[model samples]
Target: MSDINVNHILNQMRSLSLQAAGKPVQETGGSTDFSSLLQQSLASVNETQQRAGRMVDAFESGASNISLAEVMVESQKANVSFQATLQVRNKLVEAYKDVMNMPM
Candidate 1:
């Protein structure tokens, strides 16, 4: 949830719906390509995980400015994002397998 934007996801779904209905999608600043969106999402998740790790390291090193509550919150955020990414990967693999097994 930390790296995931619900609004962005909803917008993408809306765009896809428009495309399926043979309507033009409006121009937007964000990349609409699937690969680009996926890359950006993965990068966000990576950043979140890295940030959490750094915070944990700093706290373990006796950093006075860092608080246990902040570290825990960041760590949980990272874990949730990672879990979501893993689930997405699993679904993508399943989809690929299904497409491959579709016979002519």
Candidate 2:
């Protein structure tokens, strides 16, 4: 199983967003709504975690093809991804607080 690095995927998403917001995609042109991008990322994370849960359930039920090692790895990856998402949310909240505290 090829593991996708959540941070790398998020970085690529951010780069694409910067290009989309009037910066020119490949110097062509594009735009992406930040809220939609965030929603998609959240959905992706949720889906990953769900899949990991399913894998664990299958392994626990003694599914022959599902190895314990595979289950552990998938669960760990999901946990890490969720943790990363939480960190991103924390940073965003902190930034919002900083902006709100700025004097008009």
Candidate 3:
């Protein structure tokens, strides 16, 4: 990958890490709204999935224009993100169930 693309990806990853760590991207920014953060994370996951789907479609369509390495990387990213989301959902469901079963 070109230096620019690599730098962009690294920057994005850094931003994501900061968000996940409950650190604002800017000093002037305050606490992030939970709903907004959840929505943004979901949107990012959806976008990754869409990109992976497009890569698969391109490959199946006999388009050699897209590099195999790029496709693989995107696919792996989508898979990992999906798995993380699924795990989070599972944990949330379990917590809710436990709460509901608790004595008042």
TM-score of each: 0.73, 0.73, 0.68
Residues 1-104 of candidate 1 have per-residue lDDT tens digits of: 49997768878885895586466777565546788768967897899899999999999999999999999999999999899999999999999999999998
lDDT of each: 0.87, 0.80, 0.80
Task: Encode model 3's per-residue lDDT on 1-104: one tens digit a residue.
Answer: 64566545655775788788476774313344657767877888898899999998998788979888888999999999999989988998999999999999
Residue 47 CA displacement from its true place in model 1, Å: 0.3
Among all windows of 10 consecutive residues in model 2, the one with the lowest summed lDDT is: 21-30
- Candidate 2 versus the native: TM-score? 0.73
lDDT score, candidate 2, position 18: 59
Poorest stretch of ten by lDDT in candidate 1: 21-30
What TM-score does candidate 1 reach?
0.73
Ranking by lDDT: 1, 3, 2
Spell out the clash pairs found in candidate 1. none
Top lDDT prediction, candidate number? 1
